[model samples]
Target: MKRILWITLCLAVMSSCSCRQEPEQVALDFLQSFFASDYKQARVYAAPEIMGILDKSQSIFDSLTPEEHQEVKDYLSAINITVEAPEKIKGDTVRLPYRVEFSRLKEPGESFITLRREGRNWKVYALE
Candidate 1:
């Protein structure tokens, strides 16, 4: 019984330690939420500085009429976004590059997203 208890404790510890999600996944989730007009959910992934900015602004979707909102959603849906793996650019900072493609666009759009390590979690530091 003691041996079994010890094994169970070790497994629990391992699982708990692995619970943190990858930074790239967090960035993708943030983008998905932002584009889907779920600012509340998107804010969860933002760092405190970014969250403050988001809090001060009116909802990007809330200001639009229903038709406009639909149009925006359609435009976002029509675009294809691809996020690359994050690379450490400096201490506690990572740079993530992603590509955005649209049928009507003459060229794919590319941008770098920044992330910073906050305690055990990664947060969205900036979007550029």
Candidate 2:
């Protein structure tokens, strides 16, 4: 009976951990939608908690000057984005590490992004 209980506990732990998604894959999918400028698709992956914040972000984007919009788009387009590592999943959140290579710029940089599991899907929280 004790051995059976131990086996059951081990299996339960393994199954729970198996359900985790790879953070890098989640980040890549989100970035693809972002680079495509598809906010609608992107929103499908946003955390419910940040829906209001992202909506406000859309308004802020609408307020950007034409030149600024073009500049940001142009700058981002020149970079190659790749996920470097997956951070640990904690509670409702998972943080992913990424690297950006700028083809047109002299120097490039790396950064991290976070994703939170919302319902059955993972949403990119914000990039930093």
Candidate 3:
């Protein structure tokens, strides 16, 4: 009985730890898609609330000069992404925090973003 109880306790702890998604991996996937100029793929990781913001920002997106657009696209592609915060697991969901950096017309720029898990997938939460 004692051995069985100890084994069960150990298994529970290990299972919980192993079930977690690595925040770095999610952050990299998001950054890579964004860098490749694949907004659609990146959108897959965006939370529903983020999609709404993107919708409202469409006009801002359309007003960009071709060079500016390409520059932004290309710069985002080249940078390395890092997760500033590990995901906080909550009843099958996780929230991750990240920071991205890139050079813009010879000037360095940075932004903070959040990602949230939806079902079995992850999505960007918002721009900070």
Candidate 4:
């Protein structure tokens, strides 16, 4: 019984530690997956509101011809995303600014990703 109790306590602490992901990290993961056209992977980091959009995007990609899909994949693979430190906006809300650097472009494009705390985890709320 004592061993069981100790094991349970350890498991609880480990779960809690692994359950929460920082908003900035979530934003970077979402951007990298989404831009890679891996909508399935990206959806895991998205909020409920954004999940539908990712689903739709996935469906569209699935409908594309092989050549078209490869072309888009090759294009996306050449781009890189850099996520900056997250800024806390308000309670449970954070803004992550990121830069998308395309190989052919002289200047990187800037965008903002918003994340709201959902229970123990931070979720991607929106992009601006």
Candidate 5:
């Protein structure tokens, strides 16, 4: 019984410690949460700098009335964003390329998210 308990405890700790996701996944999660207006969830994947930017933008989002905010969210929900595999990885940083498509867009716009390795985790913090 003691050995079984110890093994279970070790496995739980190891699994939790290894929960860090890939940069592409972090970017997708951050973008989705941001678009959904779920700032709290987005913060989990964003770096402090990105959070600063998001906070400022959120202030603008906040200025809108409740109905306006919902309208904006509805519009954004119709847009489609496709994330691709990482296009570049150097040292401890990675660039994940993605495409954004919407009715207003004549063609998909290409962009990339920049992530830096922070300890065992990847943090989404930049764009290009």
Candidate 6:
């Protein structure tokens, strides 16, 4: 019984520790959540600076007209983003390449997303 309990505890800890998503997945998740207008969920994946920008933008977003808001939503929704594998470009920093497709446009856009390690987790540093 003691050995069984110890094994169960070890398994639980390992499972919990391994549950954190990789930086690339987190970036993709953030983009999807942001485009879906799930700001609360999206913020979880943002760095402090990004969160600050989001917080400051809240008032501006709130003041938009319904039609303007709809237009903005339409534009965001039209974007389909694909996150690529992350490469460590510098110390504790990783760069993730992504492809963005706009439904209203023909050509796709490419960009790199920068992430920094914060403790054991990674956070979005910038979208370059």
Best by lDDT: 4
Provide C-alpha RMSD values for all models, in order: 2.5, 7.4, 7.0, 1.8, 2.3, 2.4
Q: Tell me which residue pairs clash in candidate 4.
A: none
Which residue runs of candidate 1 sit more than 4 Å off their true CA positions? 1-4, 7-11, 52-58, 87-90
Which window of ten consecutive residues has the lowest lDDT sum in model 3? Answer: 86-95
Where does model 2 exceed 4 Å of error?
A: 1-21, 63-75, 87-92
What TM-score goes with each of the models? Answer: 0.80, 0.58, 0.54, 0.87, 0.84, 0.80
- Model 4, 1-128: lDDT tens per residue? 99999999999999989988888889999999998999988988889978888988899999999999999999889998988874445788888889999988999999899888888788897988
Write down the TM-score for model 3. Answer: 0.54
Q: In model 1, where is the ten-residue run with the lowest total lDDT?
A: 52-61
TM-score of 2: 0.58
Ranking by lDDT: 4, 5, 1, 6, 2, 3
Which of candidates 4 and 5 is the stronger one according to TM-score?
Answer: 4
lDDT of 2 by residue, 1-128 (tens): 99999999999999878866666777876676666555677676666665676677667767889998787677667667788664455687777777767777676677788887776557787777
Give model 5's TM-score versus the native structure: 0.84
TM-score winner among the candidates? Answer: 4
Q: Which ten residues in a row have the lowest lDDT in candidate 6?
A: 85-94
Off by over 4 Å in 3: 1-23, 35-37, 56-59, 84-88, 103-112
In candidate 4, how many Å is residue 11 off?
A: 2.2
Task: Indicate whether candidate 2 or candidate 5 has the larger lDDT.
Answer: 5
Better of 2 and 6 by lDDT: 6
lDDT of 2: 0.72
Q: Which stretches of candidate 6 lie over 4 Å from their true place?
A: 87-91
- What local lDDT score does residue 30 receive in model 6, on the 0 to 100 scale? 79
State candidate 6's TM-score. 0.80
